[model samples]
Target chain A: NAGVTQTPKFHILKIGQSMTLQCTQDMNHNYMYWYRQDPGMGLKLIYYSVGAGITDKGEVPNGYNVSRSTTEDFPLRLELAAPSQTSVYFCASSDVDRGFPGYTFGSGTRLTVV
Target chain B: AQTVTQSQPEMSVQEAETVTLSCTYDTSESDYYLFWYKQPPSRQMILVIRQEAYKQQNATENRFSVNFQKAAKSFSLKISDSQLGDAAMYFCAYRSAFGPRDTGRRALTFGSGTRLQVQP
Candidate 1:
């Protein structure tokens, strides 16, 4: 079903470089999120979209931006990538009824900023 | 802010044995959700189990089950008949029931993962 798909499974960027991480979900869910995970740490929220045309900053929004122009696509932008930005990025989608069950996560994008 | 905690940084179990991972959370909201997500070397986040704060009965899936104690704010995952495929990093996460208006926009807070090593 391709529940959630993220592009550029792996990428290496130099300092100050800019790139976009693409995420799409075929489930037509209303919620989508971008998160970054560091080694031995939990996933940190980067940005999220409730639905098409509504985007909001998450816990860790610095140096990142996101847009939700369509129900299936939500892309994360990394601007001026820095060494601190090296981590694995994940995109997840979910429906509103998440009383306890609701999220489908992507495989993740591993980015290394050198 | 709601917070989740996983005290175990690492754990190991032999194949066919049972293992339990502990997680505790702090939240003021009475309605919330707790989850266990497994991430393998492939880095795909897989949902292991989930528990609703309002539900008194714990949730179970196959060999996976959760011990949910709402009064103590504790949730633990029990994996029975563990297999090599069960080896992975397990994370505990929290989400408020009063999430954003749109379901897709809610943010999840996660605890540091516990590395599970299943030996043959």
Candidate 2:
């Protein structure tokens, strides 16, 4: 169903290098989120958007940026990547009206910053 | 701020047996949502079950069920007749209630997660 798609399943970045992680969902859901899961740790929210043109910082947004210019796309940008940014990134979406607010997650992007 | 906790870092259950994973949360709001997500070795996160705060009746789906205690602020997942497919990292997550402020609450708070092993 192409529920949620994330580009570049794996990547390795050098210190100070910048990159962007792409995420798109075909569910036409209004809510989208970006999160990173560290080794042996649970996922932590980085940023989220309610709809096109609306976005907000999440728990761990300091080193990341995101924009929602369209309903189906929300991309996270990492400027001047640091070693601490190395983690598995996930994109998720949810349609609140679907009766349950549970989210559908993408396969995830395994990013490694050395 | 809402926080989710999964006390069991690892669990093992023989195939065909039952196992329960523990989860706890801290939240002041009365209305919220809890969820269980399973991440297989393939790294795809799948929703296992969900529970609504106002619903006194526990939420169950096939072999997956949740014990929801509102007063105690505890939510746990139980997997019955475990299968090899059940071996994965299970995460417990929580979200704030829906409303105009829903945008702010849209971000889910996740616990450290529990790795479930199914022994055949």
Candidate 3:
């Protein structure tokens, strides 16, 4: 199984630009999440999805949006990117039955907004 | 609300030695989960070990073990026979068992990571 996969391992965006960070999991997990990690800081959740058509904002969801149209895909949209948005983003998935078991993380997408 | 804290920002251990990373969390809920995740240079978060709140005995996996103190709200991870591959940033996370009752919105709160250096 490909477990979890994230696209565009690295990218650079200009202020006011927009882009989507793509994430997919073949494990058929019901839970998917988007988190950003700054240097020396713990990861902060931006958004999460329970299932298709369901999404919710997390602790640090500002300047970002998410949509889960299918069980395998949960994409994060950054509208009007800013320099503060530069960080390493990770896509994760897990089965709810396991009651929040350890997440399977993607290789992470490093974003730099100038 | 829950919060996790990792007191140590950086640590060093000689190769083949042992090291313990300290973690403490604040949570009112009695039932919860604690985890230690490793992020190597590759930036992949891997689960090192996990401890259930109710479990009295500390959780151990091979050379990785957790010293879970329920009352003290302390959870420390000990890595024995450390190797170069064990060098990475470790994060402690907490998840509350009680949520909106929908059960699908549960999320983890992570502490600032501790970077471990394995000296050869």
Best by lDDT: 2
lDDT of 3 at B85: 97
In CAPRI terms, where does candidate 1 land?
medium
Candidate 3 per-residue lDDT over residues B26-114, each given as its tens digit: 98889888999999999989998988898899999999999999999999999999999999999999987656455543677899999
Best by DockQ: 2
Each candidate's interface RMSD, rounded to one decimal?
2.5, 1.2, 2.3
lDDT (Cα, tens digit) per residue for candidate 3, span A54-111: 8998889999999999999999999999999999999999765555465789999999
Over B7-90, each residue of candidate 1 has an lDDT whose tens digit, in order, gives 999999999999999999999889888899999999988888888888899999999999999989999999999999999999
| DockQ, candidate no. 3 | 0.62
RMSD of each: 1.7, 1.2, 1.4
- Listed in order, the DockQ scores are 0.69, 0.81, 0.62
- Itemize residue pairs with steric clashes in candidate 1: A31-B104
Clashing pairs in 2: none
TM-score of candidate 1 chain B vs. the reference: 0.94
Candidate ordering by DockQ (highest first): 2, 1, 3
**After superposition, which runs of candidate 3 have C-alpha atoms over 4 Å from their true positions?**
A98-100
